[model samples]
Target: MKIVFYGVITAIALSCNVQAAAIDFSTAWYQVAQKNDALQAKKEEVKYSQALQDAAKSLYLPNVDITGSYTHFDKPISVDTPPVGNFIPSFNVPLTNQNFAHSSLNAVLPVYTGGRITAAQDIRQAQVDEAQSNYNLATRATFTQLVQYYFGVVLAEQVYQVRLDAVDALADHLNHAVKFEQQGQIAKVERLMAQVSLDKAQIEAQKSLRDYEIAKLALTKMLKQQDSVLPTTPLFVNNSVTSVTPYLTKTLTDHPGIAILNAKREQAKGMVDMASAKHLPEVMLYGNYNLYSDDSATGELLPEWMVGVGVRIPIIERSGTSQEVVAAKSSVRQVNLLQMQMQQDLSILVEKTYAEMSQALEEYNSLASSQALSEETVVLRQKAFSQGLSTSLEVADSQLYATSIRVQRLSASYNYVKSLAQLLSVSGDIDHFMDYLQINGIEVK
Candidate 1:
């Protein structure tokens, strides 16, 4: 633990003034979010549950205890004038016992616990399963959020780059317009229109740059660092062959939320059995050995050993036992209802996120084509303007359309990757998602 803490501290020192370092989806999801403080706390929770499971095993083992006592009498204990004294008249019978002490060691082995031990073991196992499920849930949720912030920052950067490109393109157009107007080939109004377009592009570029900064700051927080996030991976998708059907079953079986509900249901069932077990009997086997010391005129037995069996049964209870049994069974019923509800909710989430991903990918493909066409249009129009075959308005309009389509294209690409991440998380398979990235040449290091 100390090593991990110091490692993060050292990384923080290096990152504070570090240059832009490339970070990938797998690195951020596995290294940063997986080691976040909250997720680490859940890891501790799993350990605690394991410890309880170990404790439950001791219920079947024997326990040993040591006890000692001392007693003092001012006068001493005397034997009453007895027949032994009369029979031994020749010998004087004295009675004075004082300063007595005894030390004993006792051990008890449970022979039967009325099914309590079995129930306890079941409950502990369920607890361990629940903790594991919770840890899994934490892992998925952390990765989900990190994916959003990671790609969000990248998307912002992309948008800013596009805006920057537009500003530069518009600046060139403005310069050409000025030269044409000064040469008396174009009117002053055309030059003014070019200036207006460049001004607007510059203003929007500034806003995009600020937005990009904000997104990077958000990613930094998610990474729990003082440095900026530099997403090295590009926003791309080639998961056409990957469909949503294969994952539905795996999601139902492996998703942590459903696992949690199932664990709770089992725990409730254990409680019910434990409550019923309270009405049965318990038995134990015990052994004791003792050492005694006494100063007495009448000697006593000094050391002794004893072994015995014990049993306990609850003879009667008014409504306590029955009421507990009733409540525990009802709790089982409640958990069952919750399990059903959770399964339905999980299915809905899976299907909905899958559809969103498909739609975003489709939108990205369409906008990408539009952006290509718009880029070609801008180039041809600018060439025409240079040759005196087109006006500055035509060139400026083409540039504006190009920028708009590029912005939309970047947005759609971000949504596609973001929704794909969501789908992977909903299906509880971020590792597979990482694999998909690698398969598509989006290296994660």
Candidate 2:
């Protein structure tokens, strides 16, 4: 019966290993980039902004249109001349027919718009820049999330393996205790105590398994994968200490949030220019060609074609152009202040994340010696227990202590990984995260 139970467990493990799709960090990032809806939405927004920019450029081109109209008068338009002392009979001269139809092709080209066109173009360009920055920000956020879920799975798997090992060790100890009790070499209480520890270890193993499954599910969902993912990248830590100065510098210089604010400031400046332009005169070149005229009188009255330059000067305006300029200037100030605040916030975030990463690294390094000693103690206690020189409780405690140290070390490594991702994310250096991994990472054993 025991053999069958072990066989079933082995089969299930093998099946899971076969069904799971192994993915490396680069592959996972690529999948997320291709499949994430939010990232795609941001990309579409960039395209939309670009289209608007193109439309703004068209303002520099001439606008042409064809117009046609038909009108009916109450009666035929005519003029009658009275006879001069009956020497000449009265005569009627027709000015136009009762119905008239006319059609024309008209064109207007902007010679100058008091800089309104240029200002509009500048505003649109700034909007494009802002949209691009937003997309970049979304990309960074998505990649950071991927790092968390991807490494989270690795950490959970390592923990579950440690738990399984603990359960296996306790089962061996329990088997030994049972034999010793049957041989009258140990008390029955010792055997019962070993049984209880094994039971608890098994329960802990089940909990670890559940955690692993949850972590895997999160990663799979992020990548939009139908199959379970087996992360090939192990959780890693850097032994060398890193300074936070570079990260702070990068954050202040290259962060997307800062870029967004700068674009907004440019947009506000353009708005100010546009509002000021409204107070100046506009110049345009316009031309029209008569396409058709149904009445001969109308055709004779209207010119066949005409071309002229036109100017529109604003003598008195009540459209609040001054107020608009003031509002735009205020917006500029607001954006500048926001940029400053974002810089300060990002710097603080970088510092905090760096400290946390360093702390986790330090903690992991500090536990190395303790982990070694715990393992050694576990071996010694187990040997003594088998020889009737130590109690089952002592052996169980040593085993549990070793397992605890291992789990703690794994947790510390996981924390370090997450913190590193966050630090890079804030610093706008997340694109080079893989390079850092290659340079400083040590894979967990």
Candidate 3:
């Protein structure tokens, strides 16, 4: 029985097909719709924000404008004149021109803007950095989804293989049943039972294929690919599992979820700065060069210019900049509170996933041992039946046990790998997944 069990194990190992080219997870991850859109939109937002920052920086630079106007008056103003050479009575005379035109070139350079320019630039800069954090969050979110779907396909493929093995084993049993019936060793009813089991196994294999196809199609859609992908990564548990202490310590600074929130908090703080800037007055230096045609008083064309300083003092702000400052401060407090809640939730999620990972690892290890025993039992029962020392029902029961254990082992393996990956994902350290596998000396094809 032991020899037969070893031979079966060898056969199963030898039957494994050469693995396909592995899908580059990094490449595939970039293709998912949510991540792609978030990344692209963030880039556009950065451009927009940079433009705003540039505009803010230009506040110190001078602004120049050109203006022109024409006017025709029905009655022109009269100029009061005194007698020049003689002691004549003072008189008034209407200006000859009734048409007038003026053109001007004006420029202003801000000396100060109540610190609004600086605050606005700071706000825009913070927003750009915040956009980058948002992109990182999107990446991590999409990666988490990929981990599930990616492993799902692998599990479905394993199930399909199990079903195929069961069907093949049942077909061989049906052949043996026919031979025994013809030789008068087994009843015709026994042969009918073998045929029935084979039919059921075939149906189950077909169903397993359907499930595999569905998983494959779902993965294809996520990748935005024209063809289905075959995952080359094997499912296996890390025997050298480590503690989650480092992850929790780093979560606040490194976790993409937390990073996004922190960035928002900084932006809100800048909002307070922007709102408070309105309390101070604005000052600017301005110059205007003017040309006039046919002035009513002088009846002469001339050009004139003025350069001066301007100030807009704030006396009463009816819109209440104070309220805006208060609101901005409240937003900071609210985001900080949300950040606290998220921290708590993340810690809980890590602990729960770690616990699940440990359980899956235990189940996986236990099943590995149970599978060998189940295979040995099936072989011994089959050998007994071949020697006429056991009934067909006894051999069939052994085969059923073997098949059940095989499926369970597959499930355990998948669960262990999936949970371990999930733990890293939630901790915002999925990049360390390969390191975890390496620690356990597991190789992925």
Candidate 4:
């Protein structure tokens, strides 16, 4: 007994060591989630905001530009030449090429813009907001897909294990029946039935193994990795269903759709501000300097600058600025109505998810009981067969019934998990199922 206990301990220690050395599924899933493509896209969106904010600063700064031009006149203008019909004294006048080269540096500094610059800057800011909201939505989609694939692979592995166990049990039963037949305790028909059961179990196990491989490959592809020998151990998934009503409410209030609508409405309001400002006069301070060489030497090489206030009052209004204001107001009202509709839809989705989860839980519980009873029935049928009271068909039927019950149990587990996912998806946050998401290294928050 001591020797057997020591062997078991050594085996368990070795298994633990192997597990530690192997690539853990938790870390693998974490790496996958961290490097998701959608997250990368979201990170890129921050640059758009940075650029727009920088552009807004342009409104507060003066605009400066440098320009240079060169002009060459082949025939110079000579006032001494006379051309007449009667007394045509055609005097040959000498002309030289007149080459003009000038360079100027000019600047425009806005002393006041009647708020047009500010309105334009606000419009740019609204564009950044729209990009930001789009990125947020993309991240949500990527995270949800990762969750679905991760759980799917885990379920496939579980089913594979169940099939493997069935194969082994059937093989053992076949060997025992053949021995009993040789000793004349069981008929030839019983041995043949056992052999056929073992063959069917093997076939089922092979199909399940193939399915498991395919599922593993799919998950690997999603993680952006090459095909690999999948980890023998299954991924950890938390089956617990936690409350998500508060999160759902927050999501409805703060979702990307709402953000986009708000940004659009804000942009429309800024447009109204811009149009109204068009009616108001804009004031700008400007300065320029120039030097002329031959054209009467009009300007000196010294400084030339001017600072003044400019204004323009609209004497005639073609497009009513007041109409633009009214239109913008109407748009704001439309967006508000849409937001209300979204909230109502979200509420209905939450309720439906809750109902699905409840139903899944009930089915899982019922299947669990069925599996337990089927297992006991298998044991009783096997004993009856050994005592020569039950036929081969009866034993086979019991084993198949037990297998079917196990399959149902697995299906129930999958259904329950999927329903939980649906609930989290509508809630717009999966923190309630963070334990399952932890496989991909995603923190709930």
Measured over all alpha carbons after superposition, the RMSD of each candidate to the real structure, in angstroms, is: 7.6, 2.0, 5.3, 7.6
TM-score for each candidate, following the candidate numbering: 0.86, 0.95, 0.85, 0.75
Please give, for residues 55-126, the per-residue lDDT of candidate 1 as tens digits.
Answer: 999999999999887777786665554345556444334454566666788899999888889989999999
lDDT of each: 0.78, 0.89, 0.73, 0.66
Summarize candidate 4's per-residue lDDT along 1-445 as a digit string, tens digits. 2234334433542442342223344555466557877767666776767687687878878888876767777755444667787788767553333665666677778877778888888878887898888777665565566555665666666676676666666666776787789999998988899878877866676676667667666667777765442443333324455565674776677777778878887788788788778678767777665532334222233345544555556667878887877787787788788878877887777777666766766666677678888888878887887788786667777787788777666665566566666666555555455455454422210
Best candidate according to lDDT: 2
Measured with C-alpha atoms, the lDDT of residue 363 in candidate 2 is 95
Which is superior by lDDT, 2 or 3? 2
Over 1-445, each residue of candidate 3 has an lDDT whose tens digit, in order, gives 2234335533543343233235745456646744456567866776877787777777678999998877777866678888777768779887645776767899999898876777777777777677766666666667777867877888787777777677667667777878889999978887787777766666666676777778877887777666567776666667787787876776655776777677778778878887887888889999988754455544353447889999998888898899999999999999999999999998888888778888877876787678888889878877776677777777676777777887777777767777777777667777777666556545422
Candidate 2 lDDT over residue span 109-207, tens digit each:
999899999999999999999999999999989988999899999998899889878877887898888889999999989988998887787778777
TM-score of 3: 0.85
Evaluate model 2: give its lDDT: 0.89
> Number of clashes in every candidate structure?
0, 0, 0, 3
lDDT, candidate 1, at 77:
63
The segments of candidate 4 whose C-alpha lies over 4 angstroms from its true place after superposition are: 1-26, 71-101, 180-192, 227-244, 291-295, 300-303, 312-334, 425-428, 435-445
